[model samples]
Target: MARIIGGLTTSHVPSIGKAIAQKEQESPYWKPFFDAFKPAHEWLAREKPDVAVVIYNDHGLNNFLDKMPTFAIGAAAEYHNADEGWGIPVLKPFRGHPKLSWHIIESLVADEFDITMCQEVLVDHAFTLPMALMYPGNIDWPVATVPVMLNSVQHPLPTARRCYKLGQAIGRAIDSFPEDIKVVLLGTGGLSHQLDGKRAGFINKPFDLWCMDKMRNDPEALARLSNHEIVEKAGSQGVELMTWIAMRAAMTGRVKELHATYHVPISNTGGAVMLFENNPQPHAIAAE
Candidate 1:
């Protein structure tokens, strides 16, 4: 059966990609931020997991406002990067695990999640930036991926409870697969920062830190957070934290946080990277 070795969460700020392209990691402004992911890269290099279940939101790249599914899964054999209106240099196509994706899709539907399955997708910064941070300098990513898209950009987004439940279903699906696969889950986006209006440059360090501590000690406590509170405290884009909740919920028992770093004003966003390993023992809730 497939096993979830761990989970990771990071801010997918587009400016971070720009910093990478400009080779500014050592720069004073970006040094602290880039240095934070060093341990994460080391971990990935050592573990070398076979697959990654990436949970991220689309940033108006492939899916437009005209039609958007709250939850979409990519079942494709490969996915390419998108320009996202700025002509960012496209990376090589990312390989996908169609077999496992299909397995997950079928399982999610059976569990009543009603996820949309995509055969092809042009991933945006939300997907690529985190991969670049996690696996720097690799032309091709080391592991196959299953791209899971959630709607953080749109209102009426999935409730924290719903996101957690969906993740629980995904965890079950991965475990039930017959293959002996080692998997890592990732949730990308959010610390804090408003992107529009007069309050565009907002940053709330205290709130972001509170979220990290709470997520580390008791993720169940986060399920009660309302969207309005998230927006007010974290920022408009902070809704993206829902992805982190999903990543946390997919883990077994309480998670053990391995490494975490938080930096402010990364392109008007509060940036953070958190790495966590799932406890091997099953939680009591799992038996229910």
Candidate 2:
């Protein structure tokens, strides 16, 4: 049976993509954030998961405010990345696992989650940047992917609890699949920052640190928060933390925080990278 090996959570700010295009990773402004992924790269090298289930929010490349599904999954055989007016260079198409995607779709529907299935989806930077961060300098990606997008951009978004439940359903789906493949979950976006409104350029360091701690120690506390509460504390755009919560929920087993790093003011966002080993033996929480 297929099993989840671990999860990775990181911010997907578009400027990170531009930095990659300009080869600025080691620059003073970018090095702290970029260097944090070294341990994650080492972990991936050691585990070498066969599939990556990326949970992210679409930024108008595929869905718009007029017609956005609360939850969507990519079932296509290949997912292409396009320039979403960010001026970042487009990435090559990522190979997809249709069989696993279909299984997950069917299982989610059966679980009454009402997910939208996309056979052809245009992945924007939110999806691609995290992949690039995980597999740096690779022209071709190493693992097959499944894009699980949440609607963090629109009103009436899925509540934190609902997103957690959706992730639990996804965990069940992956566990029941017959294939003997290893899967890694990638939850992209947010620690805390706001892009617009009167609170524009906001960064809540205390809240970001608190959320990160709860993610590793007591995610249930985070899930209990209402959408309004999250926006009020984390800023409007910071609601993207739902993707991180969902990724944590999908683990469905005792998790270990293998490595984590948090840096502030990355394009007005609180950039964070956390790696978790799912279902670690002897089941004890390690100090973060």
Candidate 3:
């Protein structure tokens, strides 16, 4: 049986990755962040889980105005890294694990999570930024990943409660996997910051830490927090934090803090990364 080994929450800002890769972590705004990620880098390598269920919102890349599925999972055998802006040098096709991808999708559908499964999806920074920022190119990402997309960039997104329920479903599905595997459920986005409109360049560190505390200690209240409230306090784009609630809900009480860090450099947003060990111990190697 598969068990969720732990969870990680990180900001997907492209500049965050660029800052680390360029070795310019000395930037007052960015230095604090690079230092914080060291622990996560060490921990993830130590717990070489078989699969990482990545929860992220696409920036009008895969799912656009043409049609957006509130929740989409990559079931494709391969995906391409088509950089959709902010300094992505180039893109290479990302190979997928169809066997596991399809298995999870089918399980989610059976569980009534209602997800959009992609056979051939192109991922932008939403997926790649995590690779560059947290995992970095230097580390080998051996685990298979499942990309879960939420509609945050556009309106008509799923409600906070709804996303939370979906996370629960993911947990159930992973546990149901017949083979022995360790899963890493990652919810990436937010820390109270906005990136557009008249109220751009907002950073609410107090609220960010509050949300993290509530997420770890009292999730019910956090889950109940309204989308409008998240936007008002976290910033307009910060509504994306709804996805984090889902990840928290799935993990429930099975969580342990490994590392935590938050920082706001440029205007219009704040970036943060917190890592946890879902269980006491996980393998340094996993067979997907």
| lDDT winner | 2
Runs in model 1 deviating more than 4 A are 282-288
lDDT of 1 at 65: 85
Which candidate model has the greater lDDT, 2 or 3?
A: 2
Q: After superposition, how far is residue 253 of candidate 1 from its true place, in Å?
A: 4.0
lDDT of each: 0.87, 0.92, 0.75
Error of 2 at 87 (Å): 0.4
lDDT of 3 by residue, 1-288 (tens): 777888887777666556655777777767787777788778777877777778888887677787778889898766777767666554445556677677778888998877887887777776776765656665455667778888897676688888888887887777667778888777887878787888878888899889878776777777687778888999988887876887777773357777787767533467777777775323412433
**In terms of TM-score, which candidate is strongest?**
2
- Measured on C-alpha atoms, candidate 3 has an lDDT of 0.75
What is the C-alpha lDDT profile of model 1 across 89-163, one tens digit per residue?
677789899999999999999999989899988888889888888888856788899999999888999988889
TM values, all candidates: 0.95, 0.96, 0.90
Off by over 4 Å in 3: 91-93, 280-288
Residues 1-288 of candidate 2 have per-residue lDDT tens digits of 788999899999999988998999999999999998999999999999999999999989999877799999999999999879848889999999999999999999999988899999999898999999999996579999999999988899999999999988998899888998999999999989888899898889999999999999998888999999999988898999999999999997778999989998799999998999997334222421
